[model samples]
Target chain A: MKNNVKKLSDYIDRLNWEKAPGAAECGELENLYAAVRRVKSLKPPVMPGADFPDKVVQSLARGIKRAKSRKRLLKSAAAAAAVLAVALLVYFAALKDTNIVSAMERAYGRVSAYHGTLEVVFTSGAGERQVQSVLDVWADKQGRYAIGVLEGAYQGLMTVSDGEKVWQSPPGEGALMPVFSETHEFIFELGGEIEALKAAQSARVAGEETVAGRPAYVLEVTPQGGLPYKLWVDKETKIPLQKEGAMHNAIQYTTRYIEITFAESIPDELIQVEGKNFREADIGEEESPAPAGESPDEAFEPQVRVEVDMQAEQAQQIAADSGSSPWRLDPVFTAQVFVSLQISPEGITGEYPVDYEDFTIARTDGRRMKVQVSSDKTEIKAVYLERLVRQDETGIWTVVGYDISR
Target chain B: MNEEGLKFAAEVCRQTWEPLYRYVYHKVQNREEAEDITQETYIRSLAYPKFREIGRAEYLAFFKAVAANLVKDRWRRNKKRGIQVGFDAAANLAFTEDPAEAVGERMLVEQALKTLSAEQRKVVELRIIRGYSVSETARMMGLKAGHVRVLQYRALKNLAVILSKEETSHEE
Candidate 1:
């Protein structure tokens, strides 16, 4: 029967040669099972010699060594070129115009306070949507600052710091969450964004252009692994009149800055969030409720539950015993782990020091554990280790998922 | 390269060289080219800065992906050069390289394989040629295990019919 043939075929394909029915038992399907086995056992015309593996290993070793030496040679050549360029710059200091990157850096450094309307247009599904927000930023040389978002989804978001603690109003919520100044200062300043632009792979002045009916210098910048952007700086004041760029490689979506202003000083009332209409909220104690019908005992077991502060060594030991990498214990290094887990870190080089409180370990049924690492504010980086069952031979626990922001 | 990197590269080469060489040899139908491509795959992988960072379990899959990309690039280059590249010609070339009886058997198998759909051929390649478990094949192909089993069963049944017809025609 057709059903018998299908069943016998499945059995043979499963490689249950013993359990698979014999020719007499399979009847008309006998040839099918034999054919399947023959197909499975068919070898390539040419088999690699026994020494192929060693040859491959030696070839790779040599290639890697050559690549390293070539990299060193290029580094030395680049250093020599840099010294010559510096000397040439000094000799032609009076004849040549100032570099656009330095000019832009100087212009932004002189700005103590600025306000602007940021208009961002991005594609969603079939159509486009625009988000317009009024941003007010104030900064001093001591790294003290305040930033206010007056429109868009982050209408109530306000952050103020007095060189110590940062009081931030949560987006869409009228509650002030205080965090360490060192942790949140970068979030409320434009200096960090400017510094990133200054470190772009290439920057050049693309002649003068008229922006908002005023003559401005058009500076084009291309960042590493990012799309290019153009900034129009006012010729008279050297302040940016407008900046625009495609968001990443999305040619259909664009982000632009409009209605910019530079101020001598911001109002004292605008720079402090203490008397603002916001209730204080402590985010450190907040935890999402566990899913219903899920028992903690069934999900995982706490290897070491410490309510008090513990040393880095204890955390490392807990990670090691749980079959997780000890590198997940350090907050700064854990960010790198997250990066490697999600994507390939081929040529990326930088330090990502996440401002966090501590880490907690919980052993799961599988050869993995749950790590709860909290940041300075409401954000908690919950890293869950996934025991790669198929790759258990390697004994590497991959980061299955993490909640870095939420 | 660091010691850990070298150890990892050696382990990967040990596990993957055979399957990778077979895959390339079948496509190119030339031993020398297949060996060159296999060696190049390892060299390119080791030269990558991220190769050492890749998890041990992922090394095989990464090597396969790299090998597949190299094969595709070679095919494109050959096409640009106006080379006569076809499955039948490659299969015939492989068959001619073997003994007389093996030539007949391999030609019959290659002919039967050509009868299957592209998706079915891929399943055969991953499950049979590569000797991957059903679940591993399913994961690689992004299909459910049940679906993969059904595909394999159908593909094998079709191969059986094709081979039977070839034998009958030969007898005639």
Candidate 2:
């Protein structure tokens, strides 16, 4: 009976209700036309609006905290191996009888927004290292995630992304570094577990087990190209809550969710690391009170003082060889005020004075700068660090970086 | 309610907010009304003398039952607002409003739905009424897509049989 319903469901899904179902279009089950029609007429789920979850919490005001601790709260108190014993209490509570194959699909499908603590134990690939984040990840639909390190060696680091850009706070520094190249290799494994099962030579339910206080189907499968895996899928929600992978006949790693909450449309603010205007940061430039009017442009522009007696020969020598060069440090304009500009023929006010980089040079260089800010490099290896500044959406100076002559 | 009881009630409110709102919204099919009913359900929970005594596990059921009764009251009011009865009057009912026959047909269908086993009923709700795709339903239930389809076919077939039986009984 269960399998019969499953097949009928698959057929209806394939139908997508594009046309009315009848004996002509659908055989044997033509009597339920009204039911199918009503389903088709029904509206899609209207996601709760205006920050629903946050508003509900705010509505509760003074009566949370201590009372909240009473309802299935996973005590995140155990140091290091806390989550080894973590129940993942209510996250996996809904799914009670799910198995391996269905669990993988559930985790892969239908999940657009989620927050969870992922405990990763390296069994072989790196030695014995266990990392369990008390507060781990909250990913929006865009896969822009905020990976938090709350109770580990990386106690205060947070990495957030806005699809096109990533923001990371250096451990203990609490400063937002604009972008970094961090591939969530573990997350790839989480989503990839499904594809692995699909590409597997054979997969079978090894047994039934309880993982994190939820009944789960234990699956043993060997993929076509990758490592063999043992997966625990929650019976109710079917979300793959825990994974144990093997290499060379030994357990290599296990990634388990200590707890998780799936919500409708996590706020954009979750992934926003604010006010990181890289151009405004004083790099190596020494900015002091301008002594006097040392420039011709000082009248219109605020008291321009060029106290820099930079080696002029070095700038000339650096620009000579690099054809249509983008990397130019006019010591005069940059020494006191390293203000970024669009540098057009009409030359915007606070630009690098004179033919710093002609359009031919600027265009060539601008494209490169645009690419770097968008690149996932953890650190920029540049003698001139001002290239890190990405312009605001409306600004003409969206890219401002150049490769040094060195 | 004492301070501790109020605190527990507040905690339950926080924990079950999303699911509670979804249930009300599903029943009312109106965002504004669902929100109002959801708020009202919580308000009643906080005000009820025995709210402090309700077990943590019973919070969801208690709230849902309250929402269900509220929905029934709403249906009664709409009936009072002149949903025309009798074949002659119902024949002329507007396209937007359900006719008297349609309401009877729905009641029959609802009775047929109740005859299904829990698993069968869930399949009908997720696949038929809720209109989740088989794949999506399969994912939610942690069942094979094939299994979901099979469940829906039997559930509907059973509904058709039960609905047919209801019609015969009404005629008799």
DockQ of predicted model 2? 0.09
List of chain A TM-scores, every candidate? 0.40, 0.40
Q: Per candidate, chain B TM-score?
A: 0.44, 0.45
Error of 1 at A381 (Å): 24
lDDT of 1: 0.54
Model 1 chain B lDDT-worst window of ten: B87-96
Per-residue alpha-carbon lDDT of candidate 2 for residues A78-172, written as tens digits (9 for 90 to 100) = 44245543556434453345535655676668877776666654342225343322336676556567775544333345666666555456453
Q: Taking the tens digit of each residue's C-alpha lDDT, what string does model 1 give over A244-300?
A: 554321212333343455576666776566666543323343222334786744343
Candidate achieving the largest lDDT: 1
Among these predictions, the greatest DockQ belongs to 1
Report the C-alpha displacement of residue A171, candidate 1, in angstroms: 7.8
DockQ of each: 0.16, 0.09
Q: Per-model C-alpha lDDT, please?
A: 0.54, 0.49
Candidate 1 scores a C-alpha RMSD against the true structure in Å of: 26.3
